[model samples]
Target chain A: MKESLVIQANNLSKKYRLGTIGMTSLREDLSRWWTRSKNGIPKHGFDQAGIDPTRMINDHEFWALHDLNFEITRGEVVGLIGANGSGKSTLLKILSRITEPSEGKVKVKGKVASLLEVGTGFHPELTGRENVFVNGAILGMTRREVDKKFDEIVDFAGVADFIDTPIKRYSSGMTVRLGFAVAAHLEPDILIVDEVLAVGDLRFQNRCINQMKSIAESGKTVLFVSHQMATVENLCKSAFLLNMGQIIYSGKTSDVIKKYREDMEESANLPISQRMIREGSGKCKLSGIEFRNDQNKVVDSLISGKSATIKLFFDIYEEITAPMSLSLGISNSTHVRIAHLCMKTFGKWILPTSQKSFQVNLSLSKLELNQGKYYVTSFLDDESGQIIDWVTDAFVINVLQSDFYGTGMVPPTSQSIFLMDHSFSF
Target chain B: MQKQSITVLKPSAGWTGFDFAGIWQYRDLLYLLVRRDFLAQYKQTILGPAWFVLQPLFLTVVFTLIFGKFAQIPTEGLPPLLFYNSGLIIWSYFSHCFTGNASVFTANAGIYQKVYYPRLINPLANCVSGLLGFSVQALFFVGYFCVYKIFIPTASHFEMTSAMLTIPLLIPLVASLGLGMGLWMSVLTAKYRDFNQITGFLAQALMYATPIIYPLSEVPEQYRFWASLNPMASVVESFRFALLGKGSFSFHLLCYSTIVAVLLLLSGIYFFKRTERRVVDYL
Candidate 1:
């Protein structure tokens, strides 16, 4: 016998207007009421009428999730993977009934418990013991159920010693741990986790993941959202890859990962200016930034320990040749800077010409950056120590894993970066 | 784990009604929240629950001195202390409930954003907790009445009737009115936020508009129609009549206030439910 699916979302979409004032006043109320009334009954399978032409020009309306369709069978652990702003959180919010969709409909069975953020149900003034029952209730567990699971939750959170202490006094990690324990023990039919495990220490993170795994194994459908691809691969058999508010790929975890990697590579090929860069303080003026491989074709791909150059074209608006220096730093997707290179100690090259546009290329025999998303930042400084220009995030690049480096190390070195040589004779 | 005992199932589509059953299921959570509010409010305070009694006692003395002794406002033949204290007790309960419910969304926006709960529970729990505070204050009124009856018996006349039993019924009515207005204002404040600043002023204006400091009969007869139109005016008068058995309690006014309370409460819940899911988007 085939098991029935727990959730079925058909052509679901959500649209939000940008930078508009929210509901207020009797005038806006009457207008909104009229609009909602004239649009006909908002129900599943009905097409939403177009926005009123009489209204002022809206800056823009973007679909957070667009034309998505999927089904999840009971007890399936489905991982939702996407880059930032890819609508993973939006989808989860809709599933958890925290918000309604702009279009389409979703059908869910049984009670749903969503841990969109750890410690969401906790009140700062309430004690740890009080929060357990309160949060458990917020997640749909009955009082007797909380009582039955109270001890188990306290033990799981390791907060029995401070159970009577107010949550306001608890550290953030402790709060998150206790919050997760309450949600985990509630035993809902469907569990929604959205990057909450990233809050605590490694041990707590491991415990949360294991709890989720056990939850899925206990015949409950689980929808897990995370940027941690390895964790997704290890836990979820099925995966959905979201890109630009659309489902780009949905299938077995391996296939989705492959498609996601390919899509990342395609995005990497785009010019740094055309690619999305988070709004940054443009203190330092950057004229030109390019990534080029050995053939000098401005290719996106780079081989570990192979020759590559970051050609930085700059213009010095204010003339100061006082040991002016250039520095470049690379950062991962989480914006953690992994490596840095500076021209201060290397000595600055004199401008061949006083023209506004000039080029400086940094050559590397081997790229020691790991295989993942990387962004580069360049800074301009005076040798006299008075910094002239500083650009925090200038360009982004993707460093793909190559056969030479293997999965763990860069530059294919026999000895690690620590340069340790060990012979175990136990 | 046990062999997949329950088969996979999907949630039903379409507009769903308020889940009363779900709210009932979370009753324990509601109690926990109520308990937390009760304990936490007086936790660090020096006087603790004594503050509850002192507030009304002090306010009653002040009101008696100003309205009774100075202005010589008529109290419909009740002792000045008994008259003023009755008004203060009822008004305090109403004001506390209104303020508490009105700040529900703004105060709890952090938790509202993170988890999904029946948003109704926030206001409901607040009303329940406010009732507890009101009860503590009501005990003070009883203490003062006992002293008045014993020490100053000839200063006032007192009587008890079955109409006094109707006092308990007014609890739900007063709660619903406060909750209704509170939720409506709470949702609006979430969007405009200016309402938060203005609410204190509005509540003060409402207090003066109601017969909290003076008797309903003290208002000019021409303005009595307008004063009685205020829903809370009838509520405060009814509460006074129930406790002191002196103020006016028109059955027609009671019916009208009850109707208004019901309408406000329902509309408040409707607007609150509509805004609950989307409030987080703005917050």
Candidate 2:
């Protein structure tokens, strides 16, 4: 290994069986063995078109990580960003040695501690003080190290009052703080963190960010995985964007996040009728969705704190016999629903109609959403709670910061996902 | 600022690869886990740690009534309290080791899937923590033996023999047998889950096969060979013969039990290592 290189991977890959988790039923394994014994190992199924024989271990094999390669030097904080099931977790698991790669290997010249989750080994029955030592040991600290850091850890978590209390009696926030404190104090040469910073209040989150910064600055390599693009852009100097088990982009954080946003928008831009992921009886379907400004001009992205109208087009497959309602929910990039718009909440309902196609325009006087990527999920339901059509991530909207209060001051998106209208007279 | 240890991760290690040094490096974790088990076992209960002593004490009384007084099973002419308490405490230690370690994977799946350590640390902790509970019961056994000595003065057969020196050897033998079987059970149960049901009743079923309630001499000569093959049968008998100086013990039997125990332990570790690598994926 080079002196400065901390982590090096060459064509690392992980293959998983499609239906089976770890091991299949004994019957299936026995039959496969019997067949192999009779024919001395079956050849790859060559008749299938467009199937890479190298990628397919067998019929059930799904290559979760397909020849992924990356290198991180000491003192570099590299962010791993991807959509769900994009092999981000699989790659981290491989790096942390929680699971082994299916092919190839990764060599790391340092102690690597992975915080896959904050409280990976905390026992509810154990007191906060007891759990601290246990969690520290699990995170790879010696007893003497934990003993020296015990007071600091307790003070950082702010659980000194309840240090003797069982963790089961702790508030969720307190538990998260204690767990994070133990992990944050771990003195490893390389740290792998999953989205643990997403928890806690704003102040705690800032403290965690600072802690992570200190770790990175101490000449330790840090591999951070999160869907929070803003956090990635703020923290990491370089990042890797993974898609379908392959590194699609690896460069500066901003460019990678931009590429990731572009991919999301591209997927959302696909015509509604052509999309495959939807849940409903299919009596009606979403045809198109359009975002327009107050001037009636169609906009590519919605402006924060500006009047906007959303036009939803629906194609009815069967004649409606009951009242219907449309619920439009806007969620942040992390897929947490932050705002909801419902026809029923406004005392409006779609009466029974026989039209083949119709469009409803819902207007928002002022879009209070923060500046970030937001997804629109639409649900069309009848009065009896029967879903006619439900589509997750029906549309993607990029909210741009605007001077809503006319003071030319706007809070960054990190503060919160939505802006509230209020007056403070302290 | 010493050089950091480099770790190379491959797809899998050899099946028989045992990480003895790795397990040793994680000794603090093993200690903490053992402490956690010991401290957490009796919490929220009225009697607390006293249950560790009382559990075997109550079982001995029940066995003294059911098997000794009513059923009149031969105890080699020793007091029922001494015969039953000695066997129960020794067997309790083994059962604790077995049952505790048998669920090592399932019980710690939450932590096991997230972190990488010597997975052997869990079962090893189980074995070590079992000693704490065993020690308490051992003290209780000593108390009972002293009481019998004072009250039943005519029972000369209860005197300690030179065979009692074998205890230092017997404890590890029983513990290894339990740990070996438990490791095997953990591996099998990690995937299939059907083996879990078997492990639930296995200790109780194996207890009858061992001489926990009766002497090995009581086992008819025709079935004695088969019973001695249990590995634990000779261990419990030797334990009784050591303390009570009445139950039968032979050098050959102890050697046979050690051979079987060692084999089970080595093979158990082999399979345990093989399964632990991929066990998290299943969980």
Candidate 3:
């Protein structure tokens, strides 16, 4: 324990049984209890170590978080960056007391408020004014505290005229704004947020960022988790990168984000067939994917306003006369989808022959995507709307900048992910 | 310098980790939850809050027809309406408290998974909110009893007895038994979902097991011991004797039910506190 440190974790770990967590039947519990009583109960869990992977696969037990140790000092705004299932959420759950850790401990000084979600306990039947008090109390604020900040919250949400109406009638955007407003007014010693900024419009997002900045400036601690690296870069000074239930890097936010990018690139380098992260039935599968320039030479990156072609190689196991549709989406580093190309929208479908394998080429005369790192997600669906194959973050395509308007200038990628083809008449 | 409080969270709180103070700190939330339950139930309906009184009133009349008039069940010489209303009044409180809290973990898993608060607050709120309906029905019962004794003819055997002094004491007895059993059932129902389907059936069977529609004197002496083990049996009978002054009452039976209530309350708190810490993981 240190004088300035507000939160500390020592060897914290959480083990989750993959399926059928506990006894589902009294007969099973009874038999197990009888055996344990006769053979003497075995001491297991928590302190148990050296679990083999094969045994874990068989027994359906795995540690979601393993021996995580970190500390946050007062007034520090830290970002936790990790891919899906990298244990960021488990750590947050343990910190928020929503779920207990399997081993070790986490200590915090002063009161802590965790907003794992906005409108955590809102009732649709309750009015906006009533829901505000309920949501505030669920976030650990007292009745008098909510009363003191009621006017400010309503003003911030900008729903003064409809405060007495049931939130069920409010638009989804209005509900989100009011929910975020109540959460933002909580004055706890420490605040933990998880992807709540992914909601609301751009204007409200900016308001939320400003409110977070003011909270940090007031010497309160914040531990934020998000998939959006741009927001992390803007809000956090230091960050931690987690991979496979362990902290791989911890340093300046910029350096950590670079490490995250490198991690994504490394995963993208693997051959498509060998990647473990995929979904849908295996009737048809993506065998390979490649990007090529206008000259038909294979390239890893495409330049804006230049002709390029994307080739998708599929392997079909059982063929029929059913028509199938193909879709490819490109998303920026912030995980926001920027471009989508679907065959069904154009009223065109593919009828695969008896061939076990085939290649489909999508040629673009001029790339409209802005200059940035983008990830590709591919989906294949049949006539019945059943997904044949779906892969996310299947590959990465780097888009380079070009002057579409021949002005030798371009807008920042942050302004928009698409560069429109236009000319100045004035 | 401002004084700071440090909290250290561990894997488990062990057997002795009863958090009475934690529940006390979240008392405001408990009150708000109770208010929400009371206000939110009858919304968007024509008869708002009137259903509170009408529900028990309708049940009492139905029971008076089937069990009193048709089946010829004895009410220990009291009017059938007064007898049935007396039983339904206390029975509904216990049943509401029990069944309302029985599925607490499964019903509120959404909130419990994302927030941190005393899990006991949910069931405790249900108990308190059950009182709102109980008081309304109790008032109706008192008015009906007055109508029978003073207004209705051929009903002159009713007299308020000294046992009526213990009427206020019956509230906690019923509340604790219901909450205790409900807490235990919450854990069981969360563990085995099929158990949830039978809770309503069990509550109905339990009502018949106790002397709700009939007097305790009707049960044979051989089965009275097993009947007294129900915990609610003595409470319901004592409520009848206290209010209408014409039902069975025994000191030993009352003492026995009191002990069961105390034990159930203590053990229910212990088991609920232990289960709630990690209930969300499995749920």
Query: Which parts of model 2 are misplaced by more than 4 Å?
Result: A21-58, A271-374, A377-394, A397-426
lDDT of each: 0.74, 0.85, 0.85
Which ranges of candidate 3 are over 4 A from the true structure?
Answer: A20-58, A276-329, A333-337, A340-367, A370-373, A377-392, A398-426
Q: How many pairs collide in each candidate, listed in order?
A: 7, 0, 0
Model 1 regions lying over 4 Å from their true place: A1-3, A23-59, A276-426, B1-18
Per-prediction TM-score, please? 0.79, 0.82, 0.86
* Per-prediction interface RMSD in Å: 4.6, 1.9, 1.6
Candidate 1 per-residue lDDT over residues B102-140, each given as its tens digit:
877778887776677778888888888888878987887
* Winning candidate number (lDDT): 3
Question: What is the DockQ for all candidates, taken in turn?
Answer: 0.36, 0.50, 0.66
For candidate 2, give the docking quality class from DockQ: medium
Q: Which candidate ranks first by DockQ, i.e. highest? A: 3
lDDT of 3: 0.85
Across the candidates, what are chain A's individual TM-scores?
0.67, 0.68, 0.76
Candidate 1: tens digits of C-alpha lDDT, residues A1-426: 234867888888887654334645556656667877899753222111122222113334557778888888888999998765578998998888777787888777777888887666677777898888777777778888989999999999999999999889998888989988888897778889898878789999999889888888888888998767778887899999997678988999978877876665565555443444122222224666777887787876675545688788765554444445677776665444667888766766443345655678888766665455566766666555555445445566666555443435434433332112234596
Residues B35-145 of candidate 3: C-alpha lDDT, one tens digit per residue? 888777976879999999999889989999999999999899898888889899899999988899889999999999899998988999999999999999999888887
Proportion of true contacts reproduced by candidate 3: 0.69
Candidate 3 lDDT over A225-245, as tens digits, reads 988888888899999998767
Clashing pairs in 2: none
